[model samples]
Target: MAECDAEWELCKENIQPLRQGRSVSALHQALCQQQEGNHTALNQQKQSVHQTSRLYFTFESELRLYDGDDPLDVWVRCGLLG
Candidate 1:
């Protein structure tokens, strides 16, 4: 994590020259938001993904790819429903 923080510092240094009319504070805010997922958007996205995956796995009817009855579903459902 410290190594990654050092790399983030290097990235901030490298980006300093690119800002023309931009405020240093704005640049700092953007960097802080992006550094190692320290942003609200990342948390929101993670929550969204978690909810989606839970819904996906809970709905075994959709996951039933084959046409006929699958015996594996019984065992899996037994575990999940327990």
Candidate 2:
């Protein structure tokens, strides 16, 4: 588990927390980005978050399709359950 520990050490500051935990590939990619000066990824992340935040705010009030369940499950009610 030294490799895992090393990877975590290399990218600990850049890793974002998630409910399912960090992906190994994502951790490696972050390490590579850090080795490559890290500015590009930081800026891109900032812009992406800003755009997503704006989109969320703009469409959050209008999004009424979901009823707190998976919409695709409704296909079963339309005779597709067979």
Candidate 3:
């Protein structure tokens, strides 16, 4: 959990400056620039809200996986390993 928070903080620190600058706006404009029938507009809207929230919740849920044994499939057993 701490590791995930640290990584997220590091990423935010690195991205903060660009987000504060006009680069983010320009990037958004570039991404949104499309034809009338293009699906980019709808996709961007969905990603901006729904997808972002889903990803955040997913990250939080992933922390629970670290509470016990290793998360890899090899560690899971049907009954008893012995």
- Per-structure clash totals for the candidates: 0, 0, 0
TM-scores for all candidates: the values are 0.33, 0.32, 0.27
- The lDDT values for all models are 0.69, 0.69, 0.60
Expressed as tens digits, the lDDT of each residue in 1-82 for candidate 2 is: 9999998898768646789987899889989878777787788999999988876655553344547566555444433344
Better TM-score candidate (1, 2): 1
Those runs of model 3 whose alpha carbons end farther than 4 Å from true positions after fitting are 1-43, 68-82
Pairs of residues clashing in candidate 2 = none
Question: Candidate 2's error at 17, in angstroms?
Answer: 38
- How displaced is residue 1 in candidate 3, in Å? 64
* Highest TM-score against the true fold, candidate: 1
Model 2 accuracy (lDDT, Cα): 0.69
Error of 1 at 72 (Å): 20
Model 1, 2-67: lDDT tens digits are 999988887775444544577889879888878857667788999999987887676665456535
Model 3, residue 21: distance off in Å is 44
Tell me which of candidates 2 and 3 scores higher on TM-score.
Answer: 2
